[model samples]
Target: MGSGHDTRVAVVVVTWNSAGVIEGLLRSVQGSRLDGSVRLIVVDNASSDSTVQVVRELMPDAEVLQAGRNAGYAAGMNAGMAAAGDCDSYLLLNPDIRLGPTTIQSMLEELRESGAGIVVPRLVDEFGALRLSLRREPTVLRAWGEALLGGRRAGRFPPLGEVETRAEAYDRRTEADWATGAAMLISRECLARVGAWDETYFLYSEETDFALRARDAGFALRYTPEAVAVHHEGESHESPALFSLLSRNRVKLFRSRHGAARTALFWSGVFLGELIRAARPTRRAAAWALLGNVRGVARPSS
Candidate 1:
C-alpha cells in the first residue's frame, strides 16, 4: 500500500541500563542528517541512571517513552512502536548503536526496491570491525554451531555485501533466514500483518522468533551492506549458574515451539559444548538473564 519512496520514518531504540553508551548513540544520531521526516523514538526500560534524562535533554525532539520498570526488550519496543503509529517503515535500533548518516535513507530506498518485509544494515564496531547482522534461524544446529564453533566469528570477515556466505543462500537476504534486530528497517505492511514483537521473549531470541514468523508469513528478511551501524555486543556469561540458566532458557524456547525432540538435541549439544568452552567472568549474570527469559515467556512479564 506504500508508494515509491516514503520519507516519513520512525526510529525506535530500546534501552536498559545503557546510559554510558546511549549518550554516544544519541549524539551520533543527532549529528546524522537523516531525512527531515525521520522521527526518533527512545524507549527507556527503566534505567536507574540518567539515561532517560540525558535522552530528553540531548534529543528533546526524540519521542521518549519510559517503561516505568526494567521491562523486557520486546515489550519496550512494542510500546514505542505503538506510540509511533504507522510509518512507511520503522528502524529498530539498540541504545549503543551508532548509525551512519545515510543508513536510514539507504534502507528506505532498499525497502522500495526489494519490497522485502525487513531490511537490516551492516553492523560494525567502534574499531570499525564488521559484524554479521545477518544470520540463519536459531535452530538446534545453529545454536550448537554457535556454542561450539562460535557464532559471531563472521564479524572478523568483510561485509557480506549482496552475496551468499554459508550454506546455499543462508541468511544472504536474497533469501535470509533472519536479520539482527540491532538496526533493522521493517515495512509497515509487514508490521500490520505480522504485528509487533512477541512479548514472550525477555531479551534474546525474540528477533529470531519474529524473523521465522515473518518468513512463514511470506516475507523475506534482508541484509544490506549499504546501510551500516555500530553495535557494542554485551557479554555477561561470567557465572556458571548464569550459563546454566541461559542453557535452560534456550531449551525453554526450543521446546515450547519445536517440541521435546528438537529441544533434547539442542540440550545434548550444549551439554557437550560446556566441556569444550570456558565460561566468561559474568557467567552468573548471563545465566540469571537466561532464567529471566524463561520466566519472561512463561508469564509474559512486562
Candidate 2:
C-alpha cells in the first residue's frame, strides 16, 4: 500500500454528452481533502455536447483525452486509465456523483488499513436517501429468489438474493462481492493484477466483472460508509434500451462464469422477474426489451 501522504490517486471521469451533470463531480473532486497528490483525467466519449469545454473550464490542469468516437463506457474508462500513467490508486467516477470533502481520503485510508484491493463509498441519491449499492455474486439461486420473492424481500436473506438492501449492512464497513460502479477506488496492486476493465460490456456489469475477477485474484472489495457520495442515478431505470442492456449484461456475465444449464436457469429467473413486473404500464417496455422486442431502442454510445 502507498503511504498516506505519498499516495498518488488518479481520478478518471468518462463523459458522454454530460456537460450539465459533470460540473458537480468536477467541483467536488477539486474540493476533496486528500493528503496525497491527485491527477484528474477526463475521457470524453465523443460527446456531442460541450462536455470537454466544461471540463477544461472547471479543471484547467486536468488531462483531457478525446476518444475520437463514441466508444462504450468500458472502452472510455480503459482509455482514461491508460492515460492516467503511474498512480497509487485509481478513482473511477461517474459524472453524476458528488463526493464529500473527505470522501477520497476516507476511501484511501480504508484501502490502506483493510488491505482491500477495491474500496467503495456509501452512496445516496440527490435527496440524501441511501441507495442500495452493494451486491452479492450473481447466481441461479439468487436469480430465482428475486423472481419469486422480489429483490428487497429476497435480499433480506443473503442466500436468496444478490442485492444488499438491509439498512444495517450500510451502517458499518463490510466486504462485498461487488457493488455499484458509480464511485470506487482501485488500488495500484489490484489494477496491476486484474488489468484493464473488460471492454466487452458496453456499459453495465463491467464493474461486477472486474470486482469478481479481483476477488478471484485474492483481493477483497471493501465498503466504507465513512466515505459518502451523492449519485444522481442514470437513465437505466427509465430507458428501455438501457434497461434491456443491463438485463442482457447480467445474463452474459453469469454465463461467462457458470455452466450452460445454470445459465439457462438464471436466464429463466430473470425472464420471469421481468414478466411479472410487466403487468405495470411503466415496466412494460423493459419487459418487451428483455424479450428482444426493442424496436426503437437505440444502443447507447456511451
Candidate 3:
C-alpha cells in the first residue's frame, strides 16, 4: 500500500436521470477528507433529465462521460473507470449516497490493513437506519431458505440465507462473500485481475459477480464498519420492471457459476419466492416476469 500522500484514488459515479439526488453525492465528494489526489468521474447513461448539467455545474473539474445511450450500470461504471486512466484504487458510489468526511480514507486504510482487494463500508439509509448490505455466496440451499422464509427471517441463520442481516455482524470489520454495490473501494490490483465489471449483468448482481470473481482469484472482500455511508437505495424496490430485472439477473448470475441441475434448483427457489409474494399487488409484476409471463418490459442488452 502506498503512503497517504502518494496514494492516487479515482471516484466513479454512474448516473441516470439522477439530477434530484446527485447533488448531495457531489457535495460529499467535494467535502471528503483525503490525503492523496482524487479524480472525480461521472458517467451519464443517456438520462433525459439535467443529471449531466447538474454534474458539470457543481463539479466542473470532474470528467463527465456521456454514454450516448441508457446503457446499464455496469456499462457506465466501465466507461468511468476507463476514463479515469490509472489510479491506486477506485471508489464506486451511487448517486444517492452521502459520504462522511473520512469515509474514503477509512476504507483505504482498511484495504491496506486487511490486504483486501475490495472493501465495502457500512451503509445506512437517510433515516440513519442500518441497511443489511452484506451477502454470502448464492447457493440453492440459501435460495430455498429465502424462499421458504423471507430474507430478513432467513438471514438470522448464517447458513440459511445469502444476506447477512445480523446486527452484530456489522459492528466490526470482517471479510464478506460480497456486499451491496452502492459503495465499494476496489484496489488497483484486484481491478486489473478481475478485469471490468461484467456488462452481461447490466445492473443487478454485477457487483456480486465481480466480488465473487475477486475471491476466486484469492482476493478478500472486507467490510469496514468504520467507513460509513448513507445510501438512499434505488428504484428497484419500487419499480416492478427494475425489480423483475434484479430477480432475473440473480438467476443468470447463479447459472453462470453452477451446474444446470443446481441452477434449475436455484431458479425454482427464486421462482417460488416470487410466486409466494405474487398475491401482493406490488410484487405481481416481478412474479409474472420471473414466470416469463410479462411483456413489453425493457431488458438488459444481451
Candidate 4:
C-alpha cells in the first residue's frame, strides 16, 4: 500500500455482521498504505449487527455498498468489483486480514511479470500461525484425505496441512490452478477475460472455479512469497457451517469439471464414510455437516 503513481486500488471487503473485526482490518489496510490514497469499498451483506455503522465510523471515506439482503459471498464480491470498474486491480480480501508491507505491490508485480490472472499472498494468522488458504481445488479424494489426515490428526502431523503457506511449503515461485480469493489480487485484464466469481457458490470454492477458468483462458495462477498478509481466518466461525459449504461447493465444482457418474460416486463414498464415523463424536459431527450440504441443506443464517 506504500507506492503510488496514479494506480488506484479497489480494496473490496465483504462483511456480514462483522462489527468485531471490520475496524481492525480497515485500520490494518490504512496502516499498510500510509504512503498513498486508496479507494476502500466495504460491502455490507445485510448485517444484523452494527457492522455497517462501525465501518462508517472507522473508514468514513470508504464507499459502503449496502446489499440490503444477505447476498452471499460471491454476490457481494461481484457487486464490489462492478463498482470498482477499471481500477488497476481488485483485491478481494477478508475483513480480518492485516497485510504485510508491500504485499499488494509484490502481488501486482508478479501478476505483471508472470502473465498471471490471479496472485495470492502467504496467509498467516494473528497468532503467527499459518492458514492454508492457497490450495489445489478440493477433490473428493482430497476431501477424504483431509478427513483422514486433518481435523482429528492435525496435532499429530503438521506437514499434511501446510497447503496454504506457500512461502514456507515451497522453495520457489510456482503456478497453481487458483489461489484463495482471500487476500488475492487479480489483474484488471484477467477480470475482464475470466470474469467475476461465479454466483453459484455462496462461499467456498468459487475462487477455485474462477482459477480453473483462468488457467483454461491461458493465465497462470501465481503464489508469491513476497506478497504476505496476516489473515485472521474469521470466515469460518462454526465448524459445521464451513463443512457444509465446503462439501456442497466441492460437489458443484466436481460436477462442473467431471461428470455426473463421478459426482454421484463421490457423494456415495462420503455418505458411507459418515455412517462409519457415526460412533465418533468429532468425526460424526463433521460428517453430519457434509451430509447437510449434500442433502441441499440451507444455512438458517444464509
Residue-level lDDT of model 3, residues 243-286, one tens digit each, is 98898888888878876677778778888898898876546777
Lowest summed lDDT across 10 adjacent residues in model 2 is found at 293-302
Where model 4 places Cα greater than 4 Å from the true spot, the runs are 1-3, 34-37, 140-171, 235-237, 269-286, 289-302
Put down candidate 2 lDDT per residue, 198-218, tens digits, no spaces: 899989999999999999999
Residue 121 lDDT in candidate 4:
83
- C-alpha RMSD values across all candidates: 5.5, 4.0, 3.3, 4.5
Where does candidate 1 have its weakest 10-residue lDDT segment?
Answer: 155-164
The list of candidate 1 runs beyond 4 A from truth reads: 1-6, 34-36, 143-173, 237-246, 279-302
Worst 10 residues of 4 by lDDT: 153-162
Candidates in order, TM-scores: namely: 0.80, 0.94, 0.95, 0.83
Question: 198-281, model 1: which lDDT tens digit per residue?
Answer: 776677667777877888898888777777788887542444554564466556556556655666665565544554453443
Identify the leading candidate in terms of TM-score: 3
The better-scoring model by lDDT among 1 and 4 is 4
